[model samples]
Target: MNRMPVEPPRIPRRNTGVTPSPPFRDRLMALSTNLRPAAWTRSGIAGGATIALFGWLLACAGAAGGADEVRAGAQDYRLSGEFGLSVHQVGDSIVVRWMTDALVEGSLEVTTGAGDVVHRDATEAWTSHRSAFATPAEDSIQLHYGDADARHRTWIHLAERDPRPVRITGVDSLFVMADIHGEYDQMVGILQNAGLIDEELRWTGGERHLVALGDMMSRGAEVTPVLWFLYRLEREAEASGGRVHIVLGNHEIMVMLSDLRYVHYREMWLATSYGLGYDRMFDPRESILGRWLTEAPAMLQVDDILLAHGGVSSDQLAFTVESHRDTLAAYMAEDLFHRWGDTTAFFDIDSITFNRRVDFFWGDRSVFWYRGYSDSDTLTAELDSVLEHFDSRIHVMGHTPVPGIREVYDGRMILANPLPLGDEILLLVRSEEEGRWRGERFRAEGPPLPLEVGHPEG
Candidate 1:
C-alpha cells in the first residue's frame, strides 16, 4: 500500500517577532521533511498546497496587506525580527518590496485574480524585487526567504509590525568584552578566567549579564569561531538566567556587508578554502552567526547605564531612550553601511531628514562608529550633557581601542576596548552591597588588576 502524505502542520501564530524556539523550529524541520515529495509537483514546488498554505499563513500572521492595496503611509509590515515587507500601489499594478538585509535566496509567490505568479532568485541580495501585479487576485503576496534547508528558513508578511523597546534594569554584576577582533582564544579564555563561563565553555555566571560590545568580526583568523562561540554562549547564558547582549560594533558592520580591509589573511584563506565569499559566509539566510548578528542591537540600555559601541553624544540628547531603541527597528543594520561609509556624522542635516535617512546606527558619529570619546576636547562637555539628558549615570563603550581600559569625564564614560595586544578583558561589577558600578582589567587568571588609568581631567 502506498503511504499517504502526512499533512504539514500550519505555522503557529506566537512570538511573531522573535526567532522561533528550538521545539517549534524542530517541528518546522519535520514538516519540511515530510512534505518534500509533495512539494515537487507539476506546477513546481511553489505551487505545492503545503508551500502555498505556509506562505498564506505567514502573510496573514505577519501583515494584512493581502486584499487592501498598499497606499502611501501604509503601516510597515514585518516578516521576522530582521525582515520587512512593504507594498505600494502605482496605477493598476501593485508593487511589492521586501528587505531582509542579509543575502537571501528564495521564492516570491503572488496569487492574483489572474493566477499564481512566482519569482525565484537563487541569490537575492539584501532586498527582494518590487514585482508589480497588474491585476493581482484578492489573495496576497507571500515571500519566503532562506533556502530549502530548514536551517535558514524565514517567513515574512505585509501587515505585522512589532517594535519592542530593549531595556534591562537592576543587575548585580555586568561583564562586558569588546573588540575581540576575531581573537576566539582570547574571548574564550577571558570568559573562562572571569568565571563567567567554565573551562568547558558553559555559563557559570548566575543571573549576571555579559555584554559583548561588538566588533567580533575583524582583524583575526578565527572570525567564524568567535561568531559561533558567542552564539553558543548567548543560549547558555540565557539557560543559566544570565544574559549576553552582543551589541553591534563598527567592525561587525564592516564585515557583514562585504567590507573586509581589516579581515586577517588566514580568514580570507579560509573563506577561499570553503569557496564562500565573505558576504556569503555571513549571509543571514545561510550562516547562523550572520542571522544571529543581524538580530543584535546597535545600542542597549542597562538600567541607568547605556551601552554602545561608540560613545553617545549631546547631538543624540534630543532623542528619548525609546527613540534610541527604535533606531534599530527594521533597516538600520542593512542600510547604514550602504547609504554612508563608516564615520560620517548627520549633524548638519535636519532632524526630519536625519530621522528618515539614518538613526543611531549610521552617520559619521553613529553609536557604532563614533570615535570622539577619546578626544576630550571634542566631546567632554557635550558627553556630560548627553548623559544627563538620558538620565544615564554611566556609559560603557568600546569602539576606540586604547592601550589599556580608560575612564573619561569622572567615570561617566568608560572605554572597554582592550585589543588583542592589550591581552586584558574589560570587567565591570556592580555589587548589590556597594550599589555602584566599577571597572577593572583582567587576565585569564586571578583577580582583576587595578585600573591604573585615572579619570580624564578636563
Candidate 2:
C-alpha cells in the first residue's frame, strides 16, 4: 500500500517572547535609584509603573501583529521603526521602501538563505518592482543605497532563519549512509558493533559529521526504533560538536505522502487498527519529519565530496549558484509531491529534473532502483559532463544500492550502500591539508542475521 501525502501545517508567525533587553537599562536604573529618597520617589514609582504598563502594552501590541492581516499586495508596507519587524505573505512580489535621503542607483540584491540571489535591480528612492520570488525560504533583500554625504543601508530579512548547514571543519574524515530501509534494529546493532557509534548510538569521531542519506523508514519491522535511535543520535552529535545530516529518501517521501506501496503489512495493520491512515501517520505538514525533510537539501558539498540522493543531470550543473538553490527548493515543495510516481515528469528533457529524477517514486535508473547497466559508458559520460561543469572530482551517492561499497568510472564516484548490515555505513573521506580527499568506509556491525534470512536484491 502506498502511503498518503501528508501536508505540513503552515508556519505561524507569533512572538516567541525572546526579545532584547532595553539598551537604556543603566540610565533607567540610575534614575529609579536616585528618586527613592524624596517625594519624587512616589512620583517615580508611579511613573515607572506607568512606563512598565506601557511597555507591556507595546509588547502585547507587537505580539498581536498577526500574519493573517498582512495580505500580499503592491502597497508600500512598513512596521514601526523600533521593532525587528517581519513581513508575511508579501504577495508574489515584495517592494523595499527606501527613504529619499537613502536613494542610490543600482544597489539592491535579494538573496535566499541558501545564498541564491533572486533579484538584482537598480533604483532610486521609493522604487517598486515585481520580484520573481513566490514561495518563501530563509532569505534577505539587502539594499546598498545612499550617498557619500550620509551613507545609509538596510536589509529586510524576508524569512525565518533555517538551520544553516554547519561546516564540518578540522575533521580528517566524513561518512555518509543512505537507504537503511526500516532495518533500524540491524542499523543500531551494526553501528554499536563497529564502534563508530557508542553503545548509546552517539557518533564518536572528533570533528566528523555523519550524514544519513535517507530512507530511514519502511520495509523492515523495526522502523520506529530506527527513527527514534537516529533522532537521539542527531541530538547527541550536536551536543558533541559533531553533526548528523539526514536527507530525505523515497521511503520517507512515501510515508509523507501516505503512499502505501512501500509500507509493510504489519505497520499498515497497526496504523489501520488505530484508525490512522498513512496520511495521519506521517503527514509532512504536521509531523516533525515533514518540517525536517523540507529543509534537507537535494544536494550537499563538502570539500571534494558532492552528496546528492541521485546524480545531477547535465543541465542542472550549469545553473549559477543562486539559481541552483531556488530551483532545488521549488522542486522540493509540496506541490511536486502531488505529481509523484509519474515517470513522464521525471523524463522531461527540458525541465530542471531534480524533482522528477531525484524525488520521484520509481524509474529504471533512479537512485532507488538503478542496478548495473550495459550502458554504463553512456551514463558515465553524462555524469562526467555534470561533474566537470561543477569542477568536482568525486561524487558519493547511495540511492542505488551496491554490493558493499563499489567504485565506478575509475573512481569518479563511490556508491556506498550499507543497508543490509543493520547498521548505517559512514564513508569517511579524509581531506589532506592541501585539500585532496581520500575515502574510508566504516560499517556498523550488528548481530548476524538468521541463516534463513536472505539479502534483498539491490
Candidate 3:
C-alpha cells in the first residue's frame, strides 16, 4: 500500500504572538538540509535565469524605439514598446512573458526610484514573479539589460499624484522601537498593526515622528531589508512633514568599525549568520552607510522629550547640535589601532562608565559589556544634571534591554528595550497634552528562545 507524503505545518502569522511550534523548528532544519544539495544547482539556475531575462530585455529594448512613447517631463518618461511579450497584472502578481530576440549572456539590473538597485539576476532565461506592493511616495522602476550597446530600460511610477498628508491630527502618537537587531519583518508587522506604517509601507502619521532608539543592525537574518525599509520610511515621513529619528547605538559603532577590529568574535558570528558581510559587503568607496551613520545625531529633541541611544554623559549635559557634531567628528578621526582609540567620545567600550558622574554618559556600566556594578545613585545624579541642562523633564533611551519599560529616577528617564527575550517589544510615545508625552510599552508574550545575533565584523 502506498502512503501519502506529510505536509509541513504552516507557521502562523507572527503578529498574534503565538509561539512557533516544534514542527516549525524541524521544518526549518529540513529546509536548510534540503538547500545544501541544491546550493550549486540554484546558482546554476540563477545564472540561466539571468541570461534569459537579459536576453528578453534586449529584445524588448530593440522594440522600444517603435513604441508609442511620450516624454512626460524632465524626470518622467513613458514608452510602450511593442513586443511579442505579454505584460499584465493579475490580482497581486505581475506576470511578464517575453521571447529573447538573440541569445545574450549577462546580468539584468532593476533600479528603483530612490536610486536603489532591486533585482540583479545573473542567470539564463530570466523569469520572475514579484508581488505588487502599494507605494505611496513617487517611485520608479528601471530595467537594465547588457553592459555595452545594451541600453534597454523601462521606468514606471508607482505612486498617486499629490498624495494626501498623513493624518495625525487626533493621532498625537509616536512609535519608539529599540534594539531591533535586524528583525525587519517583526518591526514592520508591529508598525503596520499599530497604524504607524500603511499597508503599502508608507508613513501614516501627520505631525508625528517615529523614534528608533538605535541598535538597528548587528543581529537577525534580514538586516539589509530592515535598513531598506527604514530608509524608505524616512523618505516617506519627510515627504509627509513627519519625521523618523534613528539614534546611534553602541552596536552601530561596532558594526561601523568592524573592519578596524573593534568588534568581538561573537559579534562577528552574529553578523555572518544573519547574512551581514562587514568587510566585503559595504563598499568604503561609495561610503553610503558611512555617510548616513556620520550624519546621525547623538540626541534628538521632540517637543519636550529627549531621545538618545545608550545615554548622555556629564559633559553632554548641555548638549547642542553643534557640540554633538564636533564631538562626533573628533571621534570619527581617531585611529582604532591606537591605545586611546576606544576612549574617543564615539567609542564607548565600557557601557557602565558612560553614565558615571565623573566619566559622563552616566549609567552603572556599559550595558552591552554587562560588568557587575550597582551604582544606581550616581546614574540618577547624572540623569538629573542632563535633564536640567536640556530643560527637558523626560529622557528616553534604549541601551539596556529591560524586561519591560522601566521608569528610573521617578519617570525622569525611561529605559526601553523592545527586544525582550529576543522577541518583539516596542514602545509608543504619545502626546497626552500639548507638551506632555506618554510612554506606553507593548510586549509579545510567548515561549522563550535564544535569538540569533548577527555581528557583521566576523
Candidate 4:
C-alpha cells in the first residue's frame, strides 16, 4: 500500500459558529529558506531499476480504483468505490473528512474503549463533508461507520499518545546514509552491501544503529515507496535491538507544505489522479510515511557526536542538547507549517540573542538547512566552535553532496551526503574503552575505503 489512500470513517462535528481554519493552507513566509538547488543528476543505474518498479505501480492500481459501500468500527476500513475518508486527532479533537459520489449515504458512530457510544451521527445522503468531535476522556477511541442498512460496516481503533525520544548512547557500530532523493535502489543496495540488511531487506545489524540523516523526500517519484520501506526497516531494526533514526531535512519541509519546485511529476500525477493534492496524499496525519516522518528528530546525538540533516550553528546550540531535541520534536509533532513562524527569531544569524533563541528546524543557519560546511575554508575552527557550544566532539552533516564520505576540519566535521552519482555510506565505530570514534567509507564492493585525511593549511 505504498501509494493508496487509507480507509476513512465519519464522526461527530463541532458546530462552531465561526468559520474554521483552511485545509493545510497557511505557510511561514521566510527569506532564503533553501540553498541553491543542487543540479539534477539522474542515476542511470537507478533509472533502470526505477523502470522495473513501474510494474509495482500497476499492481497497486486495484487498491486505488475505489469502492461504493464501506464500513468501519472495531477494525480499520479499506476505502473502495467513490467513498474516501481520513481522520486526524488534533489537540483532543477528532477531525474527519470524506469524499464521495452523489447520493451516497453513511452513518458515523464513535465510542470509548467500552461499548459506550461517545458521539454518533447519520447522513441520509452525502456528497462530501468534514466533521469534528470533542474526544471523550478515554485513552482509546473506536469508530464505527456504515450505511443505514449496516451492510458496509468498518471499524477503526485509535489511541492518542505523545511522541517518544529514540536515544542511542552505547553503540559499537553505526552506519548512516543521507540525501536519498527518492533513489530507492541506491538506498537498498548500500544497506545490503553494508550488512545492515539481507537480500530480503530484513535487519541484519544487531545492536548497531542505522541512521538516515534525512532529505528522504522530493526530487523523485519513488518517494512513497522509499519512505514506506524505511518505515518497515525501522520496525525490523527495532525488533533486532538495532535502531534507525531519520532526521528531518529541508526538502521534507518543502514537500509537507506543497513546495513543488523539486518534486518529480509522477508523484504529483499519482496524488492528483487519486483526488488528493500532493501534500494531502502525504499528509502527516493520514499517510503512514508522513506520520513516521513527523515523529523523527531534526537533531540527534549519540555520545560525543551530533548528527543532523544540515549542520546546526553554535548559536542555535544555546539550549541544552535535551532541550534542543525536545523543542524540535515538539515542533514536528504539531502542524509544522503554521507553528514555525514563531521560530523566526532563531533563524537570524545576526541576532544579538542568537544563543537565547533556539531554531532547529528552519532558516539557513538552522540544523536542517545550514551550508557552512561546504562554503568555509576555515572549517576546523568553525566546526570546533559549534561543537564546543553543545559540548560535543564531532558534528556529522548531510545536506551538501560530496564525491564520497569526506572528513573536513581535522575530522571534527563529516559531510556524508553521497549523491546518486556516488553511492556511499559512513560507518562510525566507537571504542568505549579508548573513548574514540573511527569512521570509514563503504562503497558497493571491496574493503572499507579510508577517507582523505589531513587539516587544511593555515
Residues 283-307, candidate 2, lDDT per residue (tens digit)?
4443333444555554566655666
What order do you get sorting by TM-score, best first?
Answer: 4, 1, 2, 3
Query: Which candidate tops TM-score?
Result: 4
Lowest summed lDDT over 10 consecutive residues: which window, candidate 2?
78-87
Name the regions of candidate 1 deviating beyond 4 angstroms. 1-165, 332-362, 419-422, 431-434, 455-458
Tens digits of per-residue lDDT for model 3, 1-458: 22111111111112312122234334443544534333332113332233223322322232222223211110121111111112223344332322233344434466776767665654353221112222323345655543233444544433323421222233355667777766666787667665667877678866577876677765343454455466557767778877776666655654453312222222232223224444322222223344344456556665556667666656464456446645554555444212121212233334332213112211233222221111143466777777777666776677655545556666677666643423444444555565565555543434322222221111
Kindly indicate the candidate among 1 and 4 with the higher TM-score.
4
lDDT ranking from best candidate downward? 4, 1, 2, 3
The residue ranges of model 4 lying beyond 4 angstroms of the native Cα positions read: 1-162, 332-361, 454-458
lDDT by candidate, in order shown:
0.57, 0.47, 0.45, 0.59
Predicted structure 1: lDDT = 0.57
Candidate 3 segments whose C-alpha is farther than 4 A from its true place = 1-107, 110-172, 259-277, 283-285, 333-378, 421-434, 443-458
Name the top lDDT candidate.
4
lDDT per residue, candidate 1, 33-109, as tens digits? 66556444322323234543443233222222222422111223222212222334445554444433334553345
Which model is ahead, 2 or 4, in terms of lDDT?
A: 4
